[model samples]
Target chain A: MIWPFITRSLGIATILLLAAIGELLDERAGVLNVGIEGLMLFGGAAGFLAALKWGLLAGFIVGTIVGGAFGLLHAVLSITLKVNQVVSGMGIWLFAMGFVTYWADRYSGPLPMGMVSPSIHGLSPMFFIALAILFAIWFILSRTHLGLKIRSVGEDPSTAEVSGVNVVKIRYLCTTIGGLLGGLAGAFLTLTYLACWSHLPTMGLGWVALALVQFSIWRPPILLAGALLFGFIWQFAISPETIYAGIPAPLPVLRMLPFAVTIIFLTVISSERFRKKWALAKPAALGQPYIKE
Target chain B: MIGLRFPKLKCERIVILTGADAVKISALSVVISFMLFGAFVAFEGTDPLVAYEHIFSFAFDPKLGLPITLHRGFFLVFNTLAFIIPMAAGIWNIGMEGQFYLGTIGAFAVAYSFPDLNQAILIPLMLISGAIFGAAYGALAGFLKGKMNVNEVVVTIMLNNIAFWLVYLLTVGGPWAGIAESTSKPLPKNACAPMVWNTPFTSIFVIVVAILVYFFLKKTTIGYQIRTLGSNPIVAKHVGISAPKISVIVMAIGGAIAGLSGYHMWAGDPAFLMIPRPEAYKAIGDLTYWGIILGLICLLNPLTSVPASIFIGSIIVGTTVLVRRLRMPFGLDVLFLGIISLVFAAFQFFHQYRIRRVKVVIGK
Candidate 1:
């Protein structure tokens, strides 16, 4: 029982990790893409449909591209036109949530036969992909010139520009990457985990990832740990019918755990004392639109 | 072959926009949003014009859709007011959805316990209790944001999820479980909201509230502070007022307004007087978001939201035609909201900046 739970938790962590890393990159670049939730929804809905028409690989690719395209739109809005980032994010969220939820219902067909996640010893291959991404992100943010560019742009676009960083390009780059990963994470829900189409299948997991970013204080390694723990939560706890049969658990009550914990975590993080103690640097210019005037 | 080439266009920041300029930008946004949605429908192999016609006619047909549309306006008006109030103060009450849920439970608690009370006392009691419950919840988030500098958006979202699940727990197999699966029995008739001329009396109350809010925001000192806070937080902070206090007030008030919508759903709407089934639970929040869209589209002006809410109500009524007749897909209402808002956000840029035709010489 323990082994099965751990493996399944890992699978859940994979989805969270991808989106978290994407968001981390985005925030690090000073573009607070609050629309991560919607991006994931768009990815999941479009990816599921694509997977049905073509294959699993196609689903992942389409999901990634779909996210990238929206990311591009966001970059254009937030970076180029300098539209308010939060509103742009909300617009994207509304559109994707609306469009995806609509079409998911229209095309509520059965999953393709035997479309399970290829696992070795009951552990998903996708978990390893997410781990690799986590490692790559850590390396990029710490060691590479592109990483320096992203952090500098996020910190102060004016300064980055003065120092010849091409702030707009870096922000655009990171935003797109974040959006692509967000979409990919959504695709993972339909293609790998549920292996079928469902309405709003992300079920606040996108928001869970947003919370994870804060909980991790924008660190890839801490985010990975948090994702694994939360993965063992609702998806693991209330999800299984037989495991908690003796406890007479009210499923809806249990479903509140993650969100409640998210609020509690946010409150704790916002406490001045805790922040001064363990806080890694949040991007100073986050949620601010860069103006070169 | 002779080719026609258009001059290059570019956007430059403008110092300020006049009223006419803002109106032009808004008008263009409406056109573009429709064109985009039309393109979407056309992609789905349907004539976009037909869909619009169906939506329009189905929305206004007196016998079938008009009454429901007007009834829906009751909730939208409150929802819009709830959204615009805090938003004008530069606080986002994303918990409108959750607050509405808490409002339902609050009203249910009052009505269930005082079932035999006379109509006058019980009705006001239920409505007041619902508002109080919603206010308490909204204030919690506002207090956290004001005191700690925590982001209200994320906090409200968490609260929304928790509130929804809490309601779900209560309705399904909890103490409130009355006679059916996933729902409760109807409240006593005395507790039901009173109607006048085939409309909930609260509809009149909402209009009065809107006018009062308009005056409060425009003419009152605290309202001045709220508007200042929304426009320039730095300048507002420099003023001697407490940010935390204002945040709490706006959110609590917004929550109170949002809470009334819960009463509207519970005892006001003839169709859904009972606790909603678990399946239809989250769908209720869809109304709150639609109101949010109206609030944003109208630039959070209280008076403007009145007509905007009515217009959106018709569109929402039209969504049924889209799904049932056109087989267009579910959530067309949301898609419409999304596209309009997205296009509007893009066009809102023109309010601050003007596009110019620039001559370009390649290969200098």
Candidate 2:
């Protein structure tokens, strides 16, 4: 039971970790791409469509490509246009919802009705791809000079610029890459997990990832921990049969405990004492648009 | 982009914008939003002209689509006004969705308990219960923000998830078993707020409440402080006005107002569930992000939300009709709306702020 739960949780974590690592890079670069949700949704749809038309690898590539494109858009708007972070984030959500949904519907082909691609077996190629990405992103963020520059840019782009770092370029690259990761995560949901191209298919995973970012807080390693926690939560709890029985209805309330815990965690993290002492070193200028002027 | 005509000179316009400017800006935004929406429809293999005609006729058709459009707009208006209140006070409660869902469950719980109460009494009571439920939820975020300094956006977003699952459990597990996954039983007919007009344009209670809110914000001392805090929380704090307390109070008030929509939606709309239906939209219980969209369109003002909500309502109605008729995929409206808003914001920036470009001169 534990191994099965762990495997399922690990599978879930792998998906989230892919997104979280990308977000970490994004946050480290000081650009909070709140449109992560929309990015993921678009990625999921794109990946599903690709898989439906071509194959699994093609779907994965399309998902990543779509996600990267959105990341680039975020970089352009937030870094160049200097739009408000929240506003830009909202734009991402709206644009993804609108653009992908329309495209998916327009290009839709006959697979099985409601199914985007048939599964290979119990697991999918995208699932394995997600696991590989988790490690790849972890290595890139922790080990590479590019990663260091990206982190420095997030930490203090002004200082990084002074120190000869191409802060703008670094940010643009990281955000785009992060978006790719986010898209891959989304594609995994459609092509692997559900094997369907769904409208707004990523659901609230992007939002949950944002929360996980907070819970994990500046640690690449902790992405796994946070993802595992979340995986255990949304997956393990609230069996449908148990709910259908309706003997004790408070199970629904119990299902909320994980989300509620996020609230509690945030409250704790933001406490004055916590902020002063244990506050994760957020990219110092995180979420602020990069304005050269 | 032109070179700075007045190089090294300060560009200052001292004229204050009147209501006319505000009206014009909003009007331009509406017009521009539609132009973009037209472009979207054209992209979907449909003729823009025919689509517009269909949208207009369907929206005002009065028999089939008008009521549904207005019914849909009711929550948008409710959510817009709800978020705008605290937003005016400088508190961004991204958790309005969670608070809304809480209101749904709370009001539903109350109404479900007293099934035989008169519509008048039941509606008011359910609304009150909604207010209380939303207030409590808002207070949690406010308390955290006030005491902990955790960003309200993150906290509220998380809370929205919590609220969603909470409602999910209630619908599936508890006393009320909704027909769908994220819905609850419809309230008794008598439990609904009475329609102000026989037409589904707007609910009477919402109109009355909006007026009262406009006056309260314009006239009341607390409202003044709320507005003041929004502009400069630190300054308000320096003046010993208690920013944290105001944040809590304002957010609670905002949640309560938002809850009214949930209460009335369940009461009046053909209730398939305790919560608003999510046939096409993915996120059902959480209306926070959409509320933020409304907040931005209305500049965080409830008075503006009235018309803004209607405009947005029409967009949703128009888009829904188009998608259904065209078999367009879900959430196309969100994409079109986002692009339009970005364009509108970008244009508005250009309209208001002058960005001077520097030019270099070669040696003569």
Clashing pairs in 1: none
- TM-score of every prediction relative to native: 0.95, 0.86
Candidate 2 per-residue lDDT, tens place, B79-104, comes to 77777888888777777788888887
lDDT of 1 by residue, A170-265 (tens): 988999999999999988877887787767778788888888887788778888889888887756555655455465667887789888888888
User: What is the interface RMSD, in angstroms, for predicted model 1?
Assistant: 1.2
Model 1: how far residue A235 lies from native, Å: 2.7
TM-score attained by model 1: 0.95
Q: Model 1's chain B TM-score? A: 0.92
Best prediction by TM-score: 1
Instruction: For candidate 2, list the clashing residue pairs, or say none.
Output: A29-A154, A30-A154, A98-B335, A252-B169, B97-B287, B119-B190, B184-B273, B184-B274
- lDDT, residue B29, model 2: 69
* Chain B TM, per prediction: 0.92, 0.85
List runs of model 2 lying over 4 Å from the truth. Answer: A105-148, A238-251, A278-280, B1-29, B178-186, B199-202, B270-289, B323-335, B341-364
lDDT of each: 0.83, 0.71
